[model samples]
Target: MTTPLGGAPLTSLEQDPAMAGGDADSGDAGDLGPQPVVNRTIGRRHGHHGRNWMGHGRRAKSNPELRGGFDGLNFHDQRYANGGNQFSVEPPDQGLCVGNGFVMESVNDVLAVYDKSGNELVGPVDLNTFYGYPAAINRSTGAYGPSITDPSCYYDSDTRRWFQVVLTLDRVGTTSSLAGTNHLDIAVSQTANPTGAWNIYHLPVQNNGTQGTPDHGCDGGFCLGDYPHIGADNNAIFLTTNEFALFGSGFYGAQIYAISKKALVHGAASPNVVLFNGGDPNIPAPAFTVWPATSPDGQFAGARGGTEYLLSSDAVFYDSGTSNTLWLWSVSNTRAIDKAPTALNLDVSPLTVQDYAVPTSLVQQKPGDTPLRDCFALTGCAPTYLGYPNIVYPTPRPMAVNDSRMQQVTYANGKLWGTLDTDVLLADGTHGSGINYFVINPHSGGLFANGTLALPDANLTYGAAAVTRSGRGVIAFTVVGPDNYPSAGYASFDAKIGAGDVHIAAAGAGPWDGFTGIPYLAGNRPRWGDYGAAATDGDRIWTASEYIAQTCTLTDYLTAPMFQCGGTRGALGNWATRISKFEL
Candidate 1:
């Protein structure tokens, strides 16, 4: 779920405010430009939050017309219940990784471990428990603990270890004033077995405690790191975050933390930390949230050894359909984290891609293949009501395109691969949410191939991609609209065909009505989380997505304030994250 920053419209590409700096040395050997400083203020800390916002839902009528499509594929799906009605909100911000004959999947607050045969071995427990904290405590402390949102994980084959990252936040208004603190919690599995022990570490991100003092890498202490993404190369693990102020008011810039992977895997008491931000002397101007790229084979063996790559879009806000530039950053000397690490802004021709806008309203129709009417109360509309009485008809909420930040990135076969969701103008002149991907030559900073995947009358968003050694890859994503539920699907890709035909991995069981407990919008807003996960296990591609599983759940929306729909609500639904593996 994205923190709403105000209703201000996105600025045009020409008026983008963050584009005012000059180019620095492009991380090539010997160019050895300026090095980033070490931020020693970061270290381990601990606490636990007792209460959390476990969201609510709306009733959805299953539309059969939206049920089945494009099932012809050579892959088999074995999906078990990952997380659903018993836990968090609409879309469970899903995270999954497969390695060493085990599967680890995480939602907002809980994680489940599974064997290679799709059988649960342990967990479905709160993150606090897995992080070695007491389950019940005051959640308002301005200390380090697992707020546990935006969970991302990676499995390193070289070290036979697993790593996961989540944001830790102080309860809103914990201080006398409304200020709070934010932290990043990191965990590295002690062994290949995820059910085993883990080395947990925490780093301070923002502290709004001081009214006017500037925080470590922001204009002030009010900065909060939202939407954290984790990735790794052979030498180091990188975490990228989009920094915002309290209540989601201001956008500062992206923050990158490069930690020594070897140190973490070996249980070092203290690992060196290198922090990068827009304020850094070596970073280019107008930088936003740059996504750190993960190695395709779980190890970095590219032309530039010991280097990690980062990618970002020039557009800051969503619905900005004019930006055409994608920025690339390379950090070298990662293995020597104890010493200075060189950060370079690489020069590359920005790939020319289609611009996009906010998606329109989508409908979850009635059962029996019936079409949904724009107004359910109108005459001759089948099944009188879409879900229940008093439910808003045609609930309007834009699909999650929270900035054009890269969703998932991979480094394979000496090339970089990445994809993101955007509102694109199709060749047929229709505007909808589609997936845009790029394959780039990292050394030359040139685009080898790029394309957009958009279905004729469907909307696609929240996409993740995984590439194999043979240049074969698969993209996993969610599709939803009036003619479809929130379904999970994928498409194969190769150097021969950029992206092939769409195949339905799992069609949603019912309609995704809306979420509860929000302040301003009440029960109509849909929560898609920030992103999904895609990984490769040497020969196969593994993916996960949040899809609607149950359409009707009992919900009490009247318990919250500002809700237009009061009383006990039925037809509320739950999200079941699907994890599937297929050959590419």
Candidate 2:
């Protein structure tokens, strides 16, 4: 277990602390110098031919297999098995951003855009192709590119540009293996239109200075920037990631980068990029998944040359099991990043909030008819099940509900709102997956509200919230357990009242029967999505989450060509994504 820097809350974090510089340009202790980067867009994305998984490739992760005939449980009343903009993918790393009447949704490796009336505008394009690399699975040839995953996006209304970011571990020189060097690939729309041209920028975050990046002295060869997310204030956009060893040991903590929005909007040849000293530098211990918050359009912080706030939890970071200390971070003076050494600063303060701990349960799924297992047992699935003739998946498998890290966050109503997965003791004394949320006023270093959000017998994972300028918001999550089967659900909340009941937006069709949880592949450790993404478009809150959209019997699955169960899924996995919207 890794221990964090501080344990107690810092008393009196008032604005204008009378440090060396003013509040915006205070240049506090342990502040690192900013690095610069150059970039250009390869070209406009080709056509919208979103060639999905064809159940090919041995090591391919997202070969979805549609489920079927479970223990007779129906999640929703939607006419079709799948719902609106519903599609197949494994471990839906949801990415959603709404702006200028356009909606964009990006999952594990695919992306698409639609109008307010649900008219398809742009993609369903693979991330690789969009990033100017070969698709994850080349449609014509069975070739692949470096792995790309964990995507996050936001529409910076201030600039009328949409920004999308993902992490890619470069393949070892054309071979289908990791090169131990990774980068944060970001694409910015040239205009407010989603179907228009875009510019792509790469930040070589291996931190070993291999790809023109700064050397942070990584433990292994280089570092992998996992779970990349983006947010913005009025003047600049910020990206954060969890640094881990690309090929070996070390979890180097979260890395942050601040870029000038003005420079990016104009497609500058070289833009000023501020790379902060992360966990490896021993600066105030280590900050884990310090998520940057997105504010409603035109509601950015105007004081101190525009301040962007981020929130993180050190509870699970120290592995002390539970904690109440929440780290509140602010980036000041982003307006002048175009000038050298212009006070692009980071300030961290630990605020004592509600206690939150990791979930005590394994996030179990509903009892279902194990068709994959049934076939492996009845017909002795040979090479199909990794050539193992002795593999048997149980009736009701358990889904992995990993650690309690901060999930989704937003800055609205002059406060910071965020939540993460945790454990809660119910009336029956049984521990269940729960949520701990906090609404903080960063200037004064105080929380306006914080509480637990949960249901009686279900588990909620990857909960995300989006708020309007008036404080009206929605919380989206994946609800599953002995009774629910990983359905897309949500709740309503505001500045005064906390979250309401967990409402199901789109019901799950079956259990999460992905390859990662198979005993032969991994050790029954079910692979789950990192986070759900929600954004505010005008007065509406747009959200997306992972769910099971289709199910089929073993006979239907085997009879279907290439295991594309009636166009519901692929071969090795059956995860689906559901996009939703709420009126604020």
Candidate with maximal lDDT: 2
The residue-by-residue lDDT of candidate 2 on 195-279, one tens digit each, is: 8999998888888877687776656567767778898888778999877655455567788889888888889877888877567
Cα deviation at 212, candidate 1, in Å, is 18
Query: What lDDT score is found at residue 435 in candidate 2?
Result: 71
User: Candidate 1: minimum summed lDDT over ten consecutive residues — where?
Assistant: 14-23
Tens digits of per-residue lDDT, candidate 1, 329-379, equal: 777666666555554223323454444332322323323210121222234
lDDT for model 1 comes to 0.56
In model 1, what lDDT does residue 104 have?
A: 85
TM-score, one value per model:
0.72, 0.82
TM-score top scorer: 2
